[model samples]
Target: MDRSQVEIEEQGLGANPYGLLLKALTLIPSWHYFLAFLILSLVFLYNFLEFHFLQDLFSGFRGHPVCFTYNPCSVIYDAVVSKCRVLRGRYCATPWLSSPHLQTVFLNFNGRPPVFSYRRQLFYTSDGGTIALDWLMKCDVSGGALHMNSSISRNETTPIMVVVPGLTSDSSSAYLKHLAFNTAKHGWNVVISNHRGLGGVSITSDCFYNAGWTEDVRVVINHLHKEYPKAPLFAVGTSIGANILVKYLGEDGENVPIAGAVAICSPWDLL
Candidate 1:
């Protein structure tokens, strides 16, 4: 074989440069090579231990393996999420919770900021008052205008999830936008219900939304439902807005328009 062909054959058989290293190590003492291998093994073991140790140290202990108290129910995976609640809230969490260890850790303690790139749609709270929503549409028409003027058919039964953030936050808040992004990715219609005068929307009313005030929220949910009757409506609220949502649910009771609701970290009894 030619010199080039022979060199190519050697490289093909030892892609990891084993031939060069074997020759180089031959010139060195056998004890030195053994010491080098020992060092590498310790490094690998130390790295492995450090990764798991640090993760456990930072993440804190997980929720009890047995779901809730007073019931001998052992292990979390067996318990249905909807079985127990703090104060008998309106919403029911899904049962059968299972996730990878690394995933659960990140999800529980994912402090990273959220990134949002939503197309907004404006809605009028009252005749003169208006609010802007970060719209996440999944219409059949790709890149078509889904602005306030664009007409999406009521026949489309998109699963809609409306998000309301904390008192100080808006559609762009890390928590709210993260949820909207994930839900939209799963083919659900997600929208952020920005409080009046917030989220870069122009303020037209003298009144700003508060923890107890569900008027604007009511209006937004009703308007969206009316516009898209075929689609199912679900609302999720955070912080003060969560209190408002619960109040709305309590007031409306069985007559509430939406299919289901969720409230998180609500200040129910703010004395």
Candidate 2:
């Protein structure tokens, strides 16, 4: 009654470790599984609502009545609040215009001499990477011989316009050619800023250019500024190149050194 009863009580079937583990496993479905399901459901619902609201906002901007139908009270409140902020005094309605159109023409004569001698130059990055740049300059005249025509001079007062091409574009690009020709006719020196990999030269580093990476532009601008301190410098960029230019301008703000800049068809928001 003493030893056997004590052994039986110590090794009882009701005190099985495996049974306790099984009971705990069954309780997991009741609480833990429910909590996991609740969390996932909340995440999905939040994402869905966010997407729906954004879609409605975009639809409203597109003149669709979806936002008004879905959230009429909020839309009405916003409209009323915006209306109350209006000023009573006269405000100029006309948008600001920058430059005037000028009659421009490319040289049509085939017999005339070439204006500039084109040369390719290489620039090194801070990390010892190199990028090839093509530069065009008016030819130097010599005694008793006709050199390249001086269509534009790089005097102290002369204006230099640096043309940056879009993705995979270079100095030989049709747009760049047209721009160089036009600006040359107006007695402006032009240089074409080509990207690292796309301009027929192998990129030294693995780092390729993106939309807002204006380091190359900054380098070129610094070089030009050093070369022609008194000359006015301008830049024109197209497409992705335009994005780089705009980013540079915005980053530089009022401290930009260029005399002027022109960016066309630039995508301001990359994200």
Estimate every model's Cα lDDT from 0 to 1: 0.72, 0.67
lDDT (tens digit, per residue) of candidate 1 on 115-190: 4457778887555788888786654123433333344578868789988888878877766767776676667788
**Residue 95 Cα positional deviation in candidate 2, in Å, after optimal superposition:** 29
Residue ranges of candidate 2 with Cα displaced over 4 Å: 1-117, 138-155, 268-271
lDDT of 2 by residue, 1-271 (tens): 7999888887775597989799889877578888999999977865743334344444443422212223436764565533643322232211221111110112222224344445667888886667776665423223323345444434566787888788767776655766776676666667788887866787788678888789889888888788778889999998899999988889888777798888876775777
Report the CA-based lDDT of candidate 1 relative to the real structure. Answer: 0.72
Candidate 2 collision pairs: none
Best by TM-score: 1
